[model samples]
Target: MGKKKFHKIFISMLSFILIFSFLQPSQASANEGLKINADAAILVEAETGKVLYAKNPDKVLGVASMTKMMTEYLVLEAIKEKKIKWDQTYEVSEYVYKVSQDRNLSNVPLKIGEKYTVRELFEAMTIYSANGATIALAEKVAGSEVEFVKLMNKKAKELGLKGYKFVNSSGLNNKDLKGMHPSNSGPEDENVMSARSTAKLAYELIQTFPELLEITSTPKKIFREGTDDQIKMDNWNWMLPSLVFAYEGMDGLKTGTTDFAGFCFTGTAKKKGMRLISVVMNATDENGKGTYNSRFIETKKLLDFGFNQFELKEIFPKNYEVKGHKTVSVVKGKEKEVKVHSKEPFKMVVKSTDHEKYSPKFQPNTELLNDKKQIVAPIKKGETVGYLAVQAKERESLGYLTKEEANKARVEVVTTQSVEKANWFILALRGIGGFFGDVWSSIVSTVKSWF
Candidate 1:
């Protein structure tokens, strides 16, 4: 064969192999073989918000009682900000009392003209999915459920949640609110969000207040214990370690169910120093009917896929420097260039087989650079010069719950040593040397062209 033709054929074959490698399925995508059996589902790493698996992730659907997770988050914020106290009591409103009396809804009966403390009501709402308790806490925080729904929407925006709308504090259909739905929504409107948004909410809640696990992990509790108003409250999260569908590392979260919302769950579990959050919306049985257990079954499949197929792998160690990107040019400094390295190790939860697929995407701090893309003198040791972001070398990415999280999936690049300004004499000498070098290079190039 001719040399030119042989080289062309070899290059063509190489191009095909490179393209084929990227087209192959990633370990997380391989979960496609594992059916989730839900309308919308997502699994993410709690620490990094890395999405390990998804099914119809962006499809908006009724959240049912899972709306209480927002209520829970707001109440916790209220307590933290001193807007409300846990021991503070609220008198039962007629609306709350009427809602509590309904047997069709999950609730702890609240007598007319009676009062309940914030802690008592919060427990009832979170553990038992009590709609009345949820409303009661909502009122305590915002003075009324109507106003609380506004706060829910406001906070959802603040948290960067997308594809979400809160019609009521509880996830109950607005029709079940007895004509007392939030003024901004229709009477039949039920709180709804996409699986991805739901997971993001859960991620924010856990990261902000990890102590919530203490209450959510509770299997059973007595509301108003040893009182005439006392009621036995059992947590609806069957996947808790103490519950029937107990899975190792399973902990606190929320569950929701309504005729309109069907069955939904937001669950989290920590095992082997890694935590995962999973959201399953409108889970159904083989017959295509929503069942109480179907949510847990679907959640189990997601969590199992995460724990079994993925693991925390440190792709880059602390202080590691990227090839061809280890140094930043300095202007008027003792050193012409300063070495930079990552502030922390880059760790991610990914399948072992996929570790090689990710590479460092270095982003220099443009603000710190001048016209020549060089830093001004006197750079301090450990000073941030840029960021080292992780990017999939190919098109296949496990993804993240939020774009913000994706942007933040990076480590700081800092200077290795302080750089002092060069002495005036040295600077002058360097300038003279550079002028001579440039003149010499120009004359040499002109002579070579003539030759």
Candidate 2:
């Protein structure tokens, strides 16, 4: 064969191999082999807000009681902002009175003239998914549910939530125009939200009110304890331990069901010090296993996938102590080097089985003092010299992330002790020693040449 023809044939074969290699599946994050029977679904890590898994995540649909999550967010904001108090009592309006006792809805047994503390109502709303309780809390925050829903829509905008709209504080669709929001144009007005928006709201909700897990993580709670009106309420999320669909590390969020929004769940779980939020919308009533409530089943799938697929690699343990190679050198100071301590733990999330494929780079020694050329003396004790940042790189097929987008954690690097400037006498001695060291080297080189 001619030399040119031989080269052409070789290049063709090499190109095919390269293309075929690229087509091979990446084991870092697998999307197949797990079937999620939901219209829209998403899974995200709380710390990084990194989306791990998604399926038609942005499609908009009615979210039913999941609207209560936003209602809970606003109510908590009101309490923290001192707009209301936990001990304060709210008069049970006729709206709440009727709605709470509605046989068609999930509600608390409420008396028309009876008053309840803010804490009681809040718990009833979150723990039991009480429509009237959430509406009551909404009314407490705003003048009425109509006004409260405006706040919800405003907050949604602030969160950059698109393809979603809130028509009511509770997720109920109103059949009467009197019960409709100002934005409602027709009788049927159900709150609409995409799974992505719902997940984003869940993420922000947890970040803002971390204490919410205390209320939501409970398997069961009793309102009006030790009273005639006492009603023991159980959580709708069966993911809690000892439940029919119990799962370890499963805590909360909310569940929803309606003719339009069939069996939806926005759930959170914490395992191995890592927290993840998963949202499954419009899940079928059956998993084809004769097991009803497919929302919880699919949620378990997502959460299990998240926990099993990712591992938290702790670069520095929480409340870390300075020891070993975790130290940075100090120049021209009283001490030649000082131990570096992390102000907070640094961790990176990576594929559980692909830890070896990542290369984490932490900089404090290198990037100290705004990438300082030299850290001079007179550094104060507990002074922030630099920051420790950790990044992990691995391969994944996520289009949102680059080929090596790694999880990052950062914390300040502080000086353990003051580093005073070296005295003039010490500087002079070092200069003399350095001068003699150079002279000795020159003499030694000359003597060896003579030999």
Highest-scoring model, lDDT: 1
How far is 133's C-alpha from truth in model 1 (Å)?
1.1
Residue pairs of candidate 2 with colliding backbone atoms: none
Tens-place lDDT digits, model 1, residues 172-195: 889888877778889867788999
Cα-based TM-score, every candidate? 0.90, 0.72
Evaluated at residue 24, the lDDT of candidate 2 is 35
Report the lDDT of model 2 for residue 79.
92
The clash count for each model shown is 0, 0
**After superposition, which runs of candidate 2 have C-alpha atoms over 4 Å from their true positions?**
1-30, 157-163, 176-186, 221-232, 285-292, 316-342, 362-387, 390-408, 414-451
Q: Give per-residue CA lDDT, model 2, range 379-442, as digits (tens).
A: 7777665555532354443222111112233566676777888888887887799999999999
For candidate 1, report its TM-score: 0.90
lDDT of all predictions, in order shown? Answer: 0.85, 0.75
* Best of the candidates, TM-score: 1
